[model samples]
Target chain A: MATAGTADSGSTVPTGTSSIRRMAPAEMPGSSSTTQSMKKTIGHRGVETTTGETTYKKTTSSALKGAIQLGIAHTVGSLSQKAERDVLMQDFVVVESIFFPSEGSNLTPAHHYSDFRFKTYAPIAFRYFREMFGIRPDDYLYSLCNEPLIELSNPGASGSIFYVSSDDEFIIKTVQHKEAEFLQKLLPGYFMNINQNKRTLLPKFYGLYCVQAGGKNIRIVVMNNLLPRIVPMHLKYDLKGSTYKRRASLKEREKAVPTYKDLDFIQDLPEGLLLEADNFNALCKTIQRDCLLLQSFKIMDYSLLMGIHNLDQASRERERGGAASGDRVVLEGPVTPDQRRPQAQKSLYCTAMESIQGGR
Target chain B: MATAGTADSGSTVPTGTSSIRRMAPAEMPGSSSTTQSMKKTIGHRGVETTTGETTYKKTTSSALKGAIQLGIAHTVGSLSQKAERDVLMQDFVVVESIFFPSEGSNLTPAHHYSDFRFKTYAPIAFRYFREMFGIRPDDYLYSLCNEPLIELSNPGASGSIFYVSSDDEFIIKTVQHKEAEFLQKLLPGYFMNINQNKRTLLPKFYGLYCVQAGGKNIRIVVMNNLLPRIVPMHLKYDLKGSTYKRRASLKEREKAVPTYKDLDFIQDLPEGLLLEADNFNALCKTIQRDCLLLQSFKIMDYSLLMGIHNLDQASRERERGGAASGDRVVLEGPVTPDQRRPQAQKSLYCTAMESIQGGR
Candidate 1:
């Protein structure tokens, strides 16, 4: 069961700790008195509160959804109105800020949700970037706001919250203030690099928004969800090309869709991923170009998020009544029944660069 | 009883025609066969349609709401993301166009409403104009889109359509293509004049949008609704200062809130509106200044839309069980009980410029 406040509070659980050790009843924060007080508060608000964790999750989820909906609605709507143009130095520095007051009028209806301050950085630049990536304004809005986004488990130690668009086409991740600032500064170069090389493996940044609510600045970046939703991934890895502290913890490995790190990848796949000669050369060239650009911006500690869909394993599982152990592939689209073919030899590998942090 | 296709079709009913003439059964278009076919179509679409007029009105209203919602969403969103700047020469010429396809994605969900091409003119200039007018973005959006706009009976011979915002704070009118063009060209001067004098009686243009649907270009301009919804206006006039053809038709006089003309003013209130010396001087000076500005731009045929709230009449109505015949005062805000005072002799007068047509 998910713990209350663990997702957003950044409360650390010691690495490699056993489930029994982590769940010591004496260490649990919910005492009988605390529960009684919480029940009273919930009653006063006229809302059902089954548990503190559930309430916190519901509040965070609703708040995030409201902010994202309004922010995307405004951003995409604005982009549709303006002409596409070259990114200027001023564009990089300019921030468009709007406050949705609690007491709104007929034209701007008051959302019962908490008041929020939404700030968009380099809107014009982002508009152009989205256009280059073949994303339509309406499509962008519908993806982010048409339905409630699915909250994904956050595997990163930064305690960042993750949400995937209902269609699994986009991922919205809350980032630190420094990360948001760095992304804004990196925009000019990112735009140029994307323009030069359309095939680069760099993360496709769609929008950067800072939603200030409850006196906290929650910065989020919208990017393409690299993994295909329908594909059954047998294994996934976060490869940083480093050895030190690059390992998945015992607790991390217990999750259904555990993202093993560099050390795990090295131990599990000793022979490494084998690719066709042409495909290998193209992948290497794109990665090299992307790294050069990242190095120029002094960005480091980025990892390639790789998902491997094992054809043979998937075929075997399909043969055994379509149930695969430890597989968490989302059944969004139609499954390829052809995966059952024994002649299928290659595993589908998908890789996307994740979390490009600025190096000191 | 609104006739089917009359509101949007621009079909003319001869001036001064009586209700008997309008209701001539032989001239009515809804034959049994036509009604039967319409019912069939409505049934095929699986939507409730009681009458041809209702269906048309609903379609137009929904199309309008969708376009306005998306357009305002885009415009206000864009405005919030941009900085306040001077109205450039190019700002007068730039048109931001966006297409909302029938097949929309998650980000831009498809509405069952018709596909629309929304074009916004001089967005930056309009943004600044809206700011100068003290209209907040959220308030603007909420007023226009939070609820279906109340469609007002179009009194103009030009066959223009008018919709009042739910909050009675905005008037959205469909303008002719030429009028839309004239307004765009007039924006720079309008911006300057508004900046020079904030209290000008000139029409406050909030947004200019052209929504293209069903191969018809419907241009609409959003302006401040000068008439207060809650105030009971006993008499109203549209005075263009021209005696020629400047009389309210018999049909117009039968309406609840009839907009009388110059001839009617001369015939009824021969003494003219009695005002205190100070108030009279200020009104004249403002009108004189506004007229000079309009004349400089070669604009003509603009009329003063004046509404008179009779305090004594309202008091008398309150005394007689609170029902006033022919009074269309919207019961929006709380009624000021002080209006019941028989000693309240002074009448309240409100005046705003209407239909600013450009001279050839």
Candidate 2:
């Protein structure tokens, strides 16, 4: 989400030297130093906006660095759901968030915050289902998500995308075309914005593309590949209330620490990852806050998702009346030949599936 | 997600030939028990597939549902992460298997021995997201989800519908072409097949229309006038880090359960919902399983997000080099305004915003 009150967080302005970390007892990673290091914290001037609100939302999301692991395809494989005994390879997507440190400069520790000061910026988090979705029946497909996608503050400047699977994966995003052009250029620009923060919070930019929409083009950024992973508590982890004692026992403390590798997502970290950089924990906090704390599945909030799904459901071609007896809903997308590496495609599917199983 | 092989669940068929419950659990003001107790469970009857491998894949996901909740969303919510302040929602279109139990033929569930057979059906379910969208840097915009949307799963059936949303509150679905033909010919046939399940698992049909794709006329499914509701979690029960004294002293949990006005979800839920559902204990188990579960983010994951952000960094005209942008995405949709209730969009926005702050 992007807007004036949102503090232009997508771009950070560097203060260039003064320390923002307070001198109180602090927990700086790796240093374990007795003296407080030059830790960085965000320094907000708190600008007022036309609505008389200081429009920056402060919700934090997980940083990009840890996401590859959360969304990669599972290493152990997927667990089957039936009383059947066959083991299977699960194809799923997974999502997670982290936050950059708040109030930081190039000189400080953290750099990004999930909360933006813009009305346009909705906190990027998710939660709940039937208990909530069923609460309002008339409002059902009013939105398209049982899970929340990232809410945007500014659809024009920044936004998120969504995809669905019926027979073939259908990618639907309400993101505008202009943004696509922006991504084609700005990816490298922003990568260079806060060199240290970028290094700490995410890997360097790789590839970006612009998608066309409504007679225009939108931006769809592609970065380092994310893998998908799953948390098969039945087969792995706490084991829930299963009759399988061995499985649950093997995962005691492991439950406290999520196992990141699986078919849905991978564990590939950014090269030269840091344990405690300025933006590292901030992104982690963002993941905890936006992706974790306040997430909820609401009935009418499908403006973003339904906007896309509705289009799909509404535009479906009739089944048998096409003057022919055998008609199939055929979609022609640019295909990647099998001879080439299909790594990216597989990784994305994994992340999305794992996410469906667990994330939001 | 569509194929597999495995041992049978060996669960006995249900006893006394009870139908599945399809209504909203009798909270719709005037619903009768007969309506409320429509088809409830799909005791898998081994759908008419000639292939056995496909059957195994479908059942596995169903069996695994009992294992665990995505506890990571909750644990991260409780963490001091930065993004924890707003409401978050995620969307997942999963390929899952559902059963359609036969109506009360003379045979009791006891007689069937469950046949241990479940008719394999693919429907989507939404898992709850906490307050935000997590970062899985490895994901791509068009990558992940892989499923197809058929205009009509059954052409000759009326009411042969499927549920699409997790909340089941907002959207109900059915095939559409010409309104007159759909109502007169298809609705009943479709409903008959779906009505077999009877639970609110499929979307209820609402209206009809046609869309143009590749110049062919495609019919759309009009779902009943239902809005997806927020999966509700009572605040009193969600006191995350309270001590025993704080927990006991808080009057929140002791207060009468709040009910939805026109909505029937939580309000319809028998009071003492958490206790009734045993979610408090369930919460503990979920928490223990998914903490620290994530790995780092990858570059490819943030591609779309970053790509768009980058696009905006430059003038659209500039990115296009003064030419028409190449990625022009055209969405031919329900040209006709969806003939559902007109909602006060702002009312929903308010509820959505507040939901973020109060949710877990």
Candidate 3:
């Protein structure tokens, strides 16, 4: 019954001159003057000229991050109070929102964040999905909020921002409102697929949160980082099985670790990847099933994110003192016996399905 | 419907010679030979003579602490999955148990601890109670398990071990089996009183856990620490309002920061505490309500744990470079303006009723 923005405005932070800066047409592409004026009139008190632009930007960014963390922590923390039953259809439409005022009281002390509104969609469904994926609440929070997330360069043409958790265990990607709505509608089937087949190579979404701050809505999805951090990826590819415009851009190919597409893959490996008969069958079957599900939902333009780790190349890099340029070596301390065993047993070529997401 | 110990014994640690040492009559007072032999024969494989007494003890202790932390973390983390409704009568009888075998697998990895059994009594009701007390689940987990609990010297004759949270926000006290059972039986009424009277001075019991390890059942109750960590207490007292043998022993009086008894309180303050008329009435009403509730349950031998902070002495101690030896200065670094406000507004004589519990 709690529709978004229907609740009483708990508290509001004066928009200040920052709003004007944000309303700059050149800065916010595609934002109309009408939308800017509407936002400016909603809770505008007066122009705050004393605060510098840099200070205002820093405060907003810090507050935005803090609000996101607090929202995720609180939502996940309260998951256990719900019944351990299958999520209902209505759950997909359910949205829980909490408004945090800038000025806090005894009951709600002012945390590190400023005024912001946080909303979580289909909390119960997400909770079940997270549990099915073996994601514990405490572990989730410790991974996401224990340290500041490392911002990753957004490589997509959609201009969406991306952040990787400090532990490299999860990725928080900003999504458009339409994409979020689509994901919500896809939940029931997604849940069923995961429940039936644990080996499905789909993106494992742990949570979805929307932080509304400074007259902007930032929606983010918390998903498992498919690529293993311990292994240094030698080659990466985004395969769509399509030939038309399915190649990396010239600029993209110049990057240190470019995501080579179908054309590049065929040219680089003329024979293609060799796998055991059983593994090949399993992989094909899973991909077929996943594609069928996505097609049924009228979803297209999805690509399989893949990472390849070459054992020989990794060993050579190790012998050369450390990983090669552009290769990330996350492990800090001396390798333990347990970690060493995996490296030793790894074959010449190891391919991993990172994730499956629409819009590449 | 899962009765305690009815499920398969997941895995257990080998008792080894440590069990024999634990069976020493001098160390385990009132433990009968029958109980000891019964435990030994139940899982007697062979005596681990190669492992030294010190090493075995360290391992068991570490495992015990680790198990306790894991149990608390897992239990609290899973609370939100339950329905957010009024607890039912059957909830009081509900007990959830988990067994951590020494040898863990892919599903349950070997963490910092070894084999142990953990039982949580009326988890749903406790979760509700904690929510009512304004304790967030994430905050609870952080305070209880973020770091090692500081072991406190037990002052009671009940032989209950005590541990204070690293943040000084909570106290974990080991309770006897009978006491745990009594508390479980008293839950319905306790819940009602606290629900009706938010100002009740009764002990804020957040969690009750039973850890079975080394052929022993250790029950612990997590409660509010009562004393403010920021302001050091200059004096402390345990008042039962009874005169018969209600005096601190010579040995107890010799220690610095000794918990003065009813007689010592009377001798120290002949005129007794002087409070404003409104505050006095409110305090009397709350105490009376709490006492009536306890008496209705036939619970007796309760005491009010009180701490007093003296501004003059605190200032003198501050002037002398730091706090006196007896006082604990928990806050490090420069004091924030928010924290300093309390000290400035505090009256000359500040009295706080930490908690009221039976068998104090």
Once fitted onto the true fold, the runs of candidate 2 whose alpha carbons sit more than 4 angstroms away are A1-200, A203-360, B1-94, B98-125, B128-360
The digit string of per-residue lDDT tens for model 2 on A239-288 reads 11123222212332244323222221212322523334433445444333
Q: Give the range where candidate 3 chain A is weakest over 10 consecutive residues by summed lDDT.
A: A1-10
lDDT per residue for candidate 1 within B204-252, as digits (tens), equals 6788898878777777778766564456567777776789998888877
> DockQ of candidate 2?
0.04
CAPRI quality of model 1: incorrect
How well is each residue in B1-360 modelled by candidate 3, as lDDT tens digits? 000000001111100011011112233334212232132111111112344211122223345557778889878876766555435445667999887776864334467554778899999778877876667777788878878977554323333445677876677766556667778877766665664455666666788899887677877778766554565656766676877787777766776666567788899998988766655666666677666666666655556655566666776777776658345553322223334233422211122322111111
| Rank list by lDDT | 1, 3, 2
Backbone clashes in each candidate structure, one number apiece? Answer: 19, 267, 13
After superposing candidate 1, which stretches have Cα over 4 Å from the reference? A1-360, B1-51, B54-59, B325-360
Q: Taking chain A by itself, what TM-score does each prediction score?
A: 0.73, 0.20, 0.74
By TM-score: ranked, best first = 3, 1, 2
Comparing 1 with 2 on TM-score, the higher-scoring candidate is: 1
User: Which candidate has the top score in lDDT?
Assistant: 1
- Scored by lDDT, model 3 comes in at 0.56
Which structure among the candidates has the greatest DockQ? 2
